[model samples]
Target chain A: MVTEFTPWQSLGGGVLIGLAAVLLMALHGRILGATGILGGLMRFNDPADWRLRAALLAGMASGPLVLLGLTGQVPAVDIPISNLAIVLGGVIVGVGVSYGGGCTSGHGICGNARFSRRSMVATASFMVTAFATVYVTRHLIGG
Target chain B: MRLLTAFAIGLVFGVGIAISGMMNPAKVLNFFDLAGTWDPSLAFVMGGGLLVAIPGYRMVLGGPYPTFEPRFQLPDTRVIDRRLVLGSGVFGIGWGISGFCPGGALPALGTGKPEVFLFVTALIGGLLLARGIQSRGLRTKAST
Candidate 1:
């Protein structure tokens, strides 16, 4: 019923993301963890740090424009879940990423690449929970 | 110069997300749907990312410092503690529910949809609240 597997596109996008991360590290010696950047911006104490975070966020916000330019139209985004689900998910994700010290980008991408043990464990923990949660929601509860 | 570079890199990251179809919550959710419509694009995305990152990190870290920055500000904590596991586990539930991870969600802001705003607002609130609790816990431990 849901067969949306664009391996080429996914791989291309991933390569770009990897390039971004690597470039960030090469240039600024920083990890390009999305939430970490946002969190730091929220609680920023340094002007220099705040500026860089703001710039990156602004760049991310320009995604639609970039896509519009590339594809001549922006693609429609599908949010399959309910609004309540989204809010709840958002809050939980916020708290979890904070306590976890990273999210997909940080622990999954950057941490795993560096072969960090803590990151690997964190990634596994999250992935297993994600799989279980989906099973429970889609299969068991049918949410 | 540093800020500009960061902005460019962020744009590149965002474009990658858009192209990879990671911007779609439905598609992302399908990745977790094993018994249902299981989309394996997420795996390819991660694999593609690692293919570049693994080597890129080695090249960059091999240097004493970054080209723009004076020192590499990396996380030093190596201890895989309870907080990491529990927190990540909790986060995964949210990811499973909404199909929106922080990286994916941030770029989705460009869509200017209220739902995206709502989720991001809730996310920020959650982050602040968690930080508050953690800091309080730290203070309590110190006092004890």
Candidate 2:
């Protein structure tokens, strides 16, 4: 349980995320929910929306690469879990995003900004559950 | 113009995620670790994001539709039903398990790690299953 407080980077990055959502909504009339945008592409639900979707996904997918490549700073990702656990986690998240209609950024950030009660509920739900899971997995059971 | 804006927005979004340390599963896990090594960076991220987005949303709402589109393609879902709560709960379990939400994992694609691929495959499969169920329900309603 080594804690590192990176308030500035977190704040800066958070602002950038909000700005991105703002710009996307203002310019394209779309919520910057990555799941919906990417899921739309996966399902090919609408051929008409594919171009913008593809462009956005392409840009987002490459952003981390460009930034990390330039800065040569590969942040540590220390998740003490089996590969099997990762896959299971992914499946749950994917299903949740699809059924719940958004993820953290979408509901926690974007939806909350817009005063959506649904987003609030969803945000609280995930946040609470995630907290509990982490508590049990890390604290109680000693991860 | 629209496509370019969308791309720029995506780039900014990804950069934000990476910079905020949200892309790091451990950092994200830290946020969820309330009873242990809890990290408060996630709160700052949400606050910073909301600070901009709140006013930004007002401006968008006041504008004459979107710049490149006729109408805002916003989520119109109004129900806080069982499905939403259950889905989010399930998602929370997974998120807690691995700490890679869709936003985080999608940006980590460049790493090209097999672990990422495995999670992504499962994720896509999960989405497809949900879609299948949704479409089936829709078809049943239509038939009725």
Candidate 3:
């Protein structure tokens, strides 16, 4: 059966995400862009910088862990392929984030908010590519 | 203060993703698979994102110019030209095929799933290509 999300549940999620992003900005003056955070870690070595990146990445990873630990409600995942395909998929996504100048969060959230035209184009591109890829892989090519 | 705040926010963001199920790659993949068993949870996720963003937006706009630099530094582009179209097309293709968009991917990495690693690699490759094209003066004419 297809899982459905209620408006309130979705809104609750939004409020949390927004609050997190805004709180980060208000307190640290930083935008929560995953690519920039990860990219910064890759490029820089300042001790001070490492902490934020580590924490940001950790928080993201930990979210699911906490849920799995607490609720025992694992999200359903159904990739009908070997591990190789999944790994390849990850690499492609990483490269795309780099080439796109930001990930979905950076462009979709931060960029769109600032009325950035590039971000709009980038986000749209992201969605379209995502749609097309799924169609080709799952339906057309049957990967 | 800033560092602490950033950390706190990051934690909250992570929790939100987890609770909302966006942290699960399977959920995301399902959303992309319209033909198989289409999941509409992502639409809620997007809606939730907008709800948080729209208000936060006003706060930023109403405030004094940022003393610590703006959280959002708008890209300097104005036109809806070729570079924009091509870049977007490439990005969309990747997203549709993999079901690992940026926000969804970051949280997934926390799962330590091997797939996250591979998807990330491809995402970086795409970025490099864009950078190379820009450096070669094949610039997109859409700047703020």
Candidate 2 similarity to native, TM-score: 0.94
Model 2: chain B TM-score relative to the native chain B? 0.89
**Candidate 3 chain B: minimum summed lDDT over ten consecutive residues — where?**
B66-75
TM-score of chain A of each: 0.95, 0.90, 0.83
**Where is model 3 more than 4 Å wrong at Cα?**
A1-10, A45-47, A69-78, B65-84, B117-144
lDDT tens digits by residue: candidate 1, B17-114? 87877778888888989889999988989999999999999999998999888899899998989999999999999899878889988888887878
Q: Highest TM-score: which candidate?
A: 1
Candidate 3 lDDT, tens digit per residue, B1-144?
Answer: 545556667767876765665655566666777887677777776677767776786696567654455453444557676655565565566566555666667766666666666666665665555557666654445541
Query: Which docking category, incorrect, acceptable, medium or high, applies to candidate 3?
Result: acceptable
lDDT per residue, candidate 2, A1-143, as tens digits? 46588899999989999999999888888888878876988856677699888888788777777786889865455566789889889888888887788998889888999999999999999988888888887877765
Candidate 2 pairs with clashing backbones: none
Candidate 1 chain A worst ten-residue window by lDDT: A69-78
True contacts kept of each: 0.81, 0.79, 0.53
lDDT of predicted model 2: 0.84
TM-score of the A chain in candidate 1: the value is: 0.95
Instruction: List residue ranges in candidate 1 displaced over 4 A.
Output: A1-3
